[model samples]
Target: MSPTTLTDSSRVLCPETQSPQTARPKVTTVMVKTPRVAAISLDYVLYIESAKNGPLSRRQGLSPIKWEKIVPSPRPAPMEADIVSFTWPRFQTEAILHLANQRKALQAFLFKNLVEGNLLWLAYIKDHCDYGLAVQIHGATDFLNFSNAVYNAFPARVAVKITMDNLTHLAYEEAMRAHFQHHRQIAKAIKSIRVHASVTSLTSLTVVHPDHPQQVMEVLTKDLPEWAEAIVANHPKVTTRMPPQTTNFVWVDGRKRPTTHPLDAPPSKHNTGPEFTTPRNRTAATEPCSSPSDVDDIEVIQISSGTAATSNHTKPMAPASPELESHHMETYIHVAHIHKGDKLTWARLLNHGIVHWLFFRSSSKVELIGLGFPIGIA
Candidate 1:
């Protein structure tokens, strides 16, 4: 909406320049020149606001989509302390981050999100804020000129001075992780990089295994282009393996097992027996033999295996209702990794549970599956 408009058609006394009698007469039609300001759509405004926060982390009380829908858009809040809604970036970063951390990211976020344009004019309109950050960014563009003059000219890759002291020892683990993370940072530096790292533009990724530098070099040189692998030959031939990482064990049905898989699910193994030991109190007791004959048969059957074992034995609980379990199993089963939708469905705890169990198992979730004996509610 135009906050202000000038209409020459309205009969009004001019200030000191003209008295009431000298007022301009109403005309049949009046022409007014509207400044050709680049009008941004509401979508662009929200994009600018959301860009301040990092990628959608489930840090805000609401997810990215919910935050966008529920949180107020960049238009000023209706009232102070009114608490109607909050957008992701505003609520997560600007509203909560420490002043120092917030300042480091700064109003530069606004300019960074903006495309080619005169920022000053835009900032002039959004003059009020917790900080005059947006306006300051527009002011800085004249002097900083970061997008066009500074960043574009920088080299895509900087050669690391790879050395034995840095790449080979336990002390160097942090440095190596940092080195890997440094490469990750470059990918996030630009939108194109963040979406996908182009092999041509990416720096030769140096993999220096202290003891196996030669092997590391061989693999990289073979997989990567000559320009990307130039430093491989010069890298010191070393004699050390990567420091071993401390292993974490996951508890399932109460048994603890060292987990190697990304999802922490153990490889399936054959049980070859009617019953298996159950960990106490954590999961339902191991399912028993379906038939009395199977109890004596001792036939080989494949079942998921885990590491830890206990001496106690018990009968697994039979399904509360097989049809109900089947319905739940068929529905609400998410093949994908944890997503907002999966979380929403899982939180409801619908009567059907087999699908929920399958989802938890598939997702490698141990805690939220609720496999233990059901608790009675008052």
Candidate 2:
């Protein structure tokens, strides 16, 4: 038999005539590749476990938060005048106007922010008081106006207050003393001193003697030739026995002398110290007191430019030590960077292990890259 004639046609038979044979569709498999780009957002969280260990794990996180915006509002206008709501009577309008005018000029001078302005304002106010202007205004108001005027005239006075406390006080006292001396010299230099007709306007020079009565008497008698002998007498000392509780001294021209008021005078001599004595309330054998010699250095600083008034005495500051200078030196740092996705992943490789195979259809195949520092290291 021939090979062509031996073929079996039974294998190519129809399904209906065959013994229940089944057929399935053909299937194919393929592989695909694509380029991926990555970028670092420049935001990072540092977990420093140890300096040597560095970052153990890093995972991508959310972006940083931004600052809120600010909106500004316009300022309100100043009130010019209120007729019905007046603080002072309209009759004193002239004086008010004068004061207002003076205030404007003073304000301009104060705006200069100079020490001299503060001194000038202080001196002017002190002179105003010396000339018996105290009765025109309340004492508290006078002090406030004097203080405010000087501060306004020279804002830089604040700096002086901060830098040199001692020098400033000394300067203030010296200025006041000089002012007193100048008035006396001017009176003598002119030879004829015009006395104001009104007793209220008279210049009353008061000399206070806390310690040496003899010295105070001599200063009044010798230095003030303008004053009479009666005007140079010592202030009468008051004892606990005396009837009057308080003493008053009257200043006539350049002299200040104590006068007695029969009704207000005490009876007789009494001890200088307090009367009552108890274990808890008893006085110390030696009272706490400061001697003039104890002071090391005196510095006069000008706090206000518009007035000559000064602050009470203050202690001097000590020099800065070497340890303080060393402590002032501190260290800091600033960092900046720009990174691409691939570079970011490469930088994060040590913290996050290498990526395995990836699939486009499934999200499980995706991996996250992290970048961070070790905790407590930086």
Candidate 3:
């Protein structure tokens, strides 16, 4: 015969002890390996077992009794909210507007895309903090004003793609053909509004999708050859050339300067190291420290763009000139794309910028085919 199926059941009963410390409800679990028999009283036997271990000792074949304290389950923690909202900074948007206004091909791309309905504009404002890039999503429903949309979104400093072949794209192409027939010279027509009249010529203005890695690398190779070479060689130090005027675009290992010696000599003491010129005053002298007490007699010479320190005994160093200040300031190259999208949110855009997204699209409604950001050449 097959082994009898065993089942376990538990029930709580009032405490038999009058002691307040032992007043917790008694719990008894029954493990019955055999079918119910009329000769045995299961409830009475369980009650006797719960009161003491005497019943277990008396019953020749009874299972040993066990006592366990009940523990409550813990509640789960709350989840974080995914949605976040923010306004696109005005300066970044302004830079994009400037690029669109300056470049005919860019304006035409924006115009044609705006007319078609779906546009995804992505831009990397190199100056916009350390954040990488931001993408603005526009659906067909909000194509009323092209320039306004661009200023609200951003410009294309990297690459722009047109993925639609619908009536709008065709109409724009036909208009471009008529302009080409009228002007004859492609160069002259490209300089005017006719530049935006066609979507066919956009390839020349910006790198097309699926062709970014090669094109972006080509631009980087030409503009910042040292960086490109270092990236390919996987070298820590790039000794061939100085970094571009822009700093912090990417980390170049072994670029950290050696610890500088303190240059905190009193006004009377002269610097023995190389003499550096102050850009503002055209005087040659070593840089000073904010606090003289920090350093002993050692010299501390710093090479950076900032306001010079002042001393009660020594005259204040000249401030940076306007041109120098502007040169040190951050500049950016933005890349814009035209694509399809529906639901868009500010949180999604912020997240896109934060994650250093190489080539990923989060919008469920949009398909990103091409993206390009040419390394900005000063």
Candidate 4:
């Protein structure tokens, strides 16, 4: 399923790294995998200087290993300070605390006063006559994170449950509004991998939901697009233009809406404008027309002295249209229905203001209706 450099190198190193003879390794600890096959084991050896060398003193050849099993030592008491019941004159916690004067001193204190394990075998290195190395064993950490070095050596196998949404067909811009979509099958698999403890070298992890594709393609098979871009850059410059982006705000009542008013006649109690202001909606429309308005233009009729007008002054209103009056309930719609024969009308919407949307009647295949309002209002 996955490859590791350590495993690759171990093919050669494992054959050469045989245990030395004099160091007849007595198994102190054995960590087994499924079916109880030993995956890792630790051994210890103690030795004393002697008058003469033993038969195992020569480091040249591999004789049969003298294997022996010893009774497991008593499990050590928990390392927390236990001054609640004193064994000597001074508090045990206070005496223990004094040993933590330095890092090495603290380790020495733990090795001397705390350790109590089986000493099954003994050997002395010929070169170094007196001193011998003492080895220890550790296992996987418990729920808490206070494990020694050996315990943390293996990737902490932990399962973390997580959630994913839209496990299938996602519409355009769906994630912005979509919420948690639980896939029971996928969740069952994700619970097997611990975030920081799982094997880091594995190239991929399979998500085993029925909806998930058999294999996800994160890497492309070829780099043709990058090669194409590099070739194109060496030629003459080709000007590229991107059309303006069009966004539509459809009326709740479909295409038929109250002109210059909220779509579907929303109540005034809790109503507010759209979250983002369009260019047309944020500014006033064009100034009043000097002549009778054409079908292609909207005229602002001086209906009344809008809040600032003097009482005595009243400006003449522009001639109204029967069609426009019915739609907005006020003045005419700026720019009447565009002629179907016009060339540029099909290319773009109304040019008098910012064009945020273009209305299409695909069923009927009729002339496109262009709403030329600052904010799609009447």
Candidate 5:
């Protein structure tokens, strides 16, 4: 009739039923923490050589070294031609492709899959490309979109030099100013402008029209920060150019508006998406419903949500096959270290779109140098 007592080693026995009961130790669950990936920027310098043009070479080199020195002869091709003649479409294509591949590789390294929110900016000190057609075509916009999807994502900005040659016609200068002014009417804009004049022209022109010199000078110098600030006081979106150093000006511009969080209550509602949040612990363990695969393979982990919080603890339910894993990871061979001597070859490559290919291949290297960002991360 005694009640049963259970101890560490003793089993329980029921008096009437003659049944034994055992106790099991409590199981402790532990959650391993995954480190969050840090954001980074990548920078690069594409030192392309000038193309061969017998006449232009003589003009740029043989002409008076000083901007002020008088040259009775007609000026040769503009300085712009001398600096970026080698960066042709073909070369750009090659560079772009190289960057694209590098981007893919880097995405895999960090997330174990390709997630397109990487930010990348292109910097060219004296490049004269009409526009970044190469970058746009490859995936620059896509990169921007991905960054915008995440609040912490940094927007990429392209920096380059705008020279006298970039102004195709003397008449276009007025139009460029008007166009810039239009942007100013909408928002505060920062622009870098550079003015170049032969020393003789600077001195003689200033003297000839001292009162209105800054006006003509303003036409050439409008994009400078000092000038931009003056304009911005009136027009929030003023475009000012930075002063020229060595007749060369490198400036940064916000090609797109700076990104803002919804919580911040920005003036513009251009960003299109739900407010972003740090991906914490919201991931689903099942395969993404949108994915094509249902095999539950190691290579294909289902991402229930795009939030980073969900991604932290999420793991592929199954391990990937050896071949599948190997294919996902690739190695980039450093084909060459572009140097001053290789300028001629680079020039030729630029003309052929091979430069673009090279750019793609060396994207990681260039990003490291140009923007201080890892190529893969961007």
Candidate 6:
């Protein structure tokens, strides 16, 4: 059979038994290249200060920033009183140089602490007397140059003098060996080494020896160090002193103190257990001494096994002498309550207790014949 033919505007079709043609859509892929970005680093210093205005301002204004360099504060200088003793040079040349350095150190200290630097003094202990070098300093540079020069040092010879009022005939000879060292030129720098014990640079306070009424030394009390002042104020025999009022009245944790004094109020007790006590009392006792000959001293003894074992032989030990077998018996009874902050009082009590216990335990005259209990305070 022949196929029939059909005509259309878009395509011509033949009536043949076959599948119909379909169009496939075309696809085009696009490549997008991204630009590379580089990292940027900026170094800058920033200083901030408290702002004077509010958080935001309506008007635009230019404000200039100011920078000020920071300076560290100077530490306090060591006081002359704190220097109890130092090794003095024996040669005249070395001694003169030593005094010059001392004067410089004193001046530096005064300048650091904002103290008036008018006078310079270098004091030392020699011949069991207080002697010093006092110089009136009008200018720091001129004074330094005058003392440091080795040739014709201290042109103004009248300003320099040596004190020898307390020096004995023997002491004067010894001091000459130490200070002058057989040097005529250096001796001329010192106006005189006459008998003069007073220090004229500052007002001197006399410190008398407790045992010797004749032995006395003078010190500059106005320039005493903190530690020396503390020792003097807290001495056991001092009676006219009171507890520091400034510390007692200061606010605690930035809060106002109540109307009642803290010591006057009843303290609340905290019970930690039976190991501690509430009362504050202490007692000590010692056993009565017995004649050394009446007590028998045993050094050692062997322990025997059961009767099943064979009998063993042992050597008998001789009785020890009373001096060799000496022992002391003492009992300490302490029951007290303490707080952690009471360190000073606790230290004093502990020192007394240890001394008492040591006296009996270490004594060589006692006889060994008593039971011992531990010495302690609860």
lDDT of 1 at 2: 53
lDDT of each: 0.29, 0.27, 0.30, 0.27, 0.31, 0.29
| TM-score of candidate 6 relative to the true fold | 0.13
Instruction: State the lDDT of candidate 1 residue by residue for 1-378, as single tens digits.
Output: 254655666545667776457668787975443222222111112222243455422246544432221122343321121111233233223222221133444344433432333222222122222222322223333323321221233221111010111112443687788878756543333322122221211222223334432322112113322222222223342111221221211111212122222123332321112244444543432337456655554433333543233323444344332222222232324223234455445444452232234333332222232332122200
lDDT of 6 by residue, 1-378 (tens): 224543455353654855788998889887542232211111111111213222222223446322211111232222221111122222222323333344564323323322332223232212211122333323444334323331222121222322222224455678787655435433332212112222322333333333443443333324323213333345453211211223221112212222222123233321111121222342222224755643443122222321132122334234332322221111121212334465664464353333222232232221111111112322
Instruction: Give one digit per residue, the lDDT tens place, for model 4 in 89-177.
Output: 23223333433333453334334433342222121222221212322212112111212211332222211111112223243245444
Minimum summed lDDT over a 10-residue window in model 2 is located at 327-336
Give the Å error, residue 315, model 1: 92
Per-residue CA lDDT of model 5 for 138-244, tens digit only, reads 35444433223221321222232111122234346877888788677434433222223321212121111223332222122222344445455564433333232
> After aligning candidate 6 to the native by TM-score, how far in Å is the CA of 261 from where it should be?
41
Best by lDDT: 5
Candidate 5, residue 258: lDDT: 25
Q: Which scores higher on TM-score, 3 or 6?
A: 6
Residue 286 in model 3: shift from native, Å?
A: 99
**Local accuracy of candidate 2 as per-residue lDDT tens digits, 1-378:** 565563575345566765764797689776432222111011111112122222221222333222111111121222132211222223123222332244553233223322332211112322333421222222345544543443333321110010112334566798999888767654553232112111111122223233432222111122233332122232244211111112232212222223222122243311111132334443333323645554333333332323243222434234332222111011001111212333543444333332211110111111120023222211
Q: TM-score of the candidate numbered 4?
A: 0.13
In the order shown, what is each candidate's alpha-carbon RMSD? 30.6, 50.6, 42.1, 31.8, 48.7, 40.5
Error of 4 at 179 (Å): 16
Residue-level lDDT tens digits of model 3 in 301-337: 4534332432325443453322222211011102234
Pick by TM-score: 4 or 5, better one? 4
Backbone clashes in candidate 4 total 9
Better of 3 and 6 by lDDT: 3
Clashes of each: 5, 42, 12, 9, 56, 1
